[model samples]
Target chain A: MGSNNSLAVRCRSLVKSYGSGDAKVTALRGVDLDVREGELLMVVGPSGCGKTTLISIIGAILSQDSGECIVLGHDLQRMNETERATLRGGQIGFVFQMFNLLPSLSAVENVAIPLLINGTPQKMAESRAREAIEAVGLGSRPNVLPSELSGGQQQRVAIARALVHDPKLIVCDEPTSNLDHDTGVAVMDVLRGAGKKHDRALIVVTHDPRIFQFADRIAHMDDGKIIEVTNGASAL
Target chain B: MLRVAVKMLMGDRAKYAGLVFGIAFTSFLVTFAASYFTGFMTRGFALISENPTVDVWVMDPAVRSVEKTTNMAASALDRVRSIEGVRSAVPMALGTAEVRFANGQFQSFQVIGVDDATLAGVPPPKDGVVPAALRTPDSVIADPGGTSGKLQTPLRPADQWPGGGPRLDVPTRSLTVGDELLVNDHHVTVVGKSEALPRFPPRPLLYTTYSNASRILLPERRRMTFVLVSAAPGVAASDLAALIEARTGLRARTSDDFKADTVSWFLENSEDVGDIAAMLTLAMSVGFGVTGIMLYMFTTENLRQYAVFKAMGASSRMLLAMIFVQVALSALLGTGLGLGLCAIASQFAVEAEYPFRMMWFTPLVSSVMVVIVSVVAAAISARPVLTLDPAIVFTGR
Candidate 1:
């Protein structure tokens, strides 16, 4: 993909590290990547590679050490913490492998949090959260706590939370790694349906081959760098 | 967000309860301790506290407290009575005398002598109206020590060592209207037990007539320890005290000034109340530490949630406010539980006649402390969340 008016995320020669001196661990080393306005892209790699780190940098959750990185036409490298938080909150969504739904909140409330953080009125957020949850196919269990849900069901709730605020970009880090083979496929299908919108883009970092069919493009990472970009799972 | 914050706390049932219990224990300790110590301060002036009718107390110029008095000339009573604005003056002889108990033990007492004609400054006999004041030469009245027979009619556990000191538990048998005791080797009958001053290190108190007390005390000259005087109508006790002081050349203090003098004396001379002060200090330190630690652990455990909120665009101020709400709510809930316990305890303390008054200001002051605890606790827990990178949500770390 190329950086154009519709590009949701763009980066070139970005770098990042964990520590300093003898303890330093370089996580990202001069990587370039792009995703159009409406696309479902997956970045896959081995466990120690920088697949998660790259997605984290793209999501504005982590700052790169040095780079030109732009998401939704805004340069992340130049922004302060407060501005980055505002951008991430209003424009991005994140899904995790562990399905980090707060144990204290019910499924709908967990899904409603992003909207609440975005300053939507609570009643409106909850009503929208119900629709988002229903879209991901858990309408009957809106009030259930995360602990009560099965692995696949909880991931679906995580997906609902990511989609509820209608962000321009969604990032998933091993979103299906915890589920069984069949359950992972099911969750990937729901994520695929939600990610392929004209105004939004999706990026999933995964090792699971079962859900590779859902990605419009796949970026392979190795040793803190992107090694290949394939058009679809057929290039696997 | 604050509503969610509270619901979040309520959701963590086991931890929430633990946090509340910690705060409740702190609250109970501080509130009850303050009330208890403030009540104890009044015991320093228990003398005039018992005799509410006496407006002015005339004693020798050297007298500092009722417990530490010097004998004034008996003629000072006549002098005070003749002063302008003086309504009446009656001599009261207060002295410490040794009385032998049935246990073959002799205990010392602060003996009181009331005027035979006026019976002024004498607490009424508990069972009946005032009888002829010490008609018999060798008769003495005992004080039931503020319990007014509660100590006799089935003793309570708290009264066993009430006001706790060595040699204070000397009342082996309760006194009655006709029991005989020896005061200063002189045989005396217990004419009637009455309610007297509430004192610490509660010694046995004995009362007799002015003439008989003069004989028992054997002061070097004809003397009375004090002249209990009242102000005439439309006369301020303080105003009348100056006139009596000028006329009698003796120390004349209104009840309030005398009470203040006694308080000042006790504050300077007494080391016994230091235990209560120490307990108060311990309660406050523990309250601050325990409540702060519990809330800190609670916030540290929930640090990830705050980061997630931060990642989701909640400002540091907003998340900080949420944590503050949790701390404030827990403080109020716990303090209320502790105060309820204190209220129940106070009823029994009052009934048992232990000086445990719960002043209104204790709760007011404790609430302020709770506010401080809330801010400090929240600030402690807010540190991790404040500097949080929000990026932690993206990594297993």
Candidate 2:
């Protein structure tokens, strides 16, 4: 563990159930995890193994039947929807595997969305978006739309969007699953670079093994529970 | 984000064009149809109304409007002229006469006989020429199409006496632009052409001096058909109408009241106004329908992106704002184009002698309708977008 002890994301005794009695399907059972500030962590699991459910709960996009999820020092269950959304906007960023960029927006415009949503003036938001896009090595492609970019470039734009708001935590759901191996590595490099430069906690949830090398730590899960945890030294 | 939504709506050339086209077409139908209804109502009382220069219009207490009915009396004209606010009162008579065109065809015409000294109730041409008495009693001031044989005066079908062979005969004498016409064998001359006015059941029109019409239409009778009242400046027509109504027990109405009454009469008596209103309503409905469909498509197409925004920490308010902005922008553009088209179309209609005058509220009202429909459509489309799971983007669901 790093020396600094600021916890960016924490979950304790999280219990999530799908149904009751005979047809019950437990997605998360008695799980606990802590992600420290400035660390890049990868969550690996087989399909339907609850890695997604854990990330969802941490992002405040889903609710756990029973548990405590304190993300960026705010308890998810204690806040109302509006309060939670406000906290989410102020403290978190999200990147999707599909590079969910708005088709109507240009690369720079897509990156400016989070700032715009947070009520930043358009000029300032666009300026900040430009910086984020440049950080992802897309300095010259700011005006190109998602459709005009390759898979790798699209994901870079998604990364630029996630970092544009300067949030404390970045939760990425399969950020590189759709990309080819080389493009996926390039995207992960950009993500790790941003995480380290910004000193924010990054949690990437995916089943892709190719992305494991960019993470400082890895949590392995099976059957709704973490089976093993390893550091970057051992992951390599 | 508003800029983004706008760019998205305009990004696809075909879709944007289609959306604008649909909206403009819907707007055209709404304005055009409404204009027709409004124009028809205006035509019902256009004769007495087209002249705003006349300060007051007085009719018998029993007459709702100057066009629909008449009362026999020359006494009211002299009495009205003696009132304090009255600047002048002129005797004007509206009657139907048979005009024999040069082609030997005869047609019914609306003949307005006004006093030569004070053409108070006469409709002047665009150049504002008052109709004067012709040198001869047969001459008449006529509109271009007023000479056509197609002109037919509207009258109750049962009012015609079956035994009376076409009550009046065609003038045997040939007439020129300034020549006299033997109307009912009484010679009357053409003064000059008055401005063309549209009538509900269109007929050719003629304008002559008041004395000649008094003798021709009421050959055996002793008074004018109606006396028009003109109040002095600063006097209210309503007060005058009240004065005339109280004194004579004749149905006296202000000009506006008279016009409105005529409109109500036509709406009640004829199916034209009602049919036009129904068609205008249908057009408005179709406009709403088109906007709804276009907005629905726009929202549905952008749902996934909306979900992404939500996942990226955008609130429902922000998403809704984006939608409203997109729709408002589209509506403004469509309304602009539609108003332009309506203006062009109105020019053609007017040139063709089809009465169409666009009101000031048409564009404002139509734009409001479009925005309302857009909001409802956006709200419906937002439901699916609001429910989309952010996790699905990764899971392939």
TM (B chain), model 2: 0.80
lDDT of all predictions = 0.81, 0.75
Q: Please state the CAPRI-style docking class of candidate 1.
A: medium
> On residues B1-397, what C-alpha lDDT tens digit does candidate 2 reach at each position?
7777788788877888888887788777777777877777777777756656565566665566545766566777777776677667787778887864432345677777777676655555424444554425455676542234353222332322224445333333322344434466565555555556577666667776777666666464534666677777877888876876676655656677777888878877677667777777877887879878987897887777777777677787777878878777777788778878998999999887786867788767766776677778878877777666654554533
Off by over 4 Å in 2: A1-6, A13-31, A120-124, A196-199, A215-236, B50-53, B70-84, B96-106, B116-135, B144-194, B208-225, B232-234, B267-269, B368-397
Question: What i-RMS does each candidate reach, in Å?
Answer: 1.5, 2.0
Give DockQ for candidates 1 onward, in order.
0.59, 0.47
RMSD of each: 5.4, 5.8
Q: Alpha carbon lDDT of residue A231, candidate 1?
A: 80
Instruction: Give the alpha carbon lDDT tens digit for every residue of A36-111 in model 1.
Output: 8778888988886888778878888788999889998889998888888898888888888878788989999999
Model 2 per-residue lDDT at A70: 93
lDDT of 2 by residue, A79-177 (tens): 877777777677788888778887778999999988988889999999999999999999999999899999889999999998999988889989888
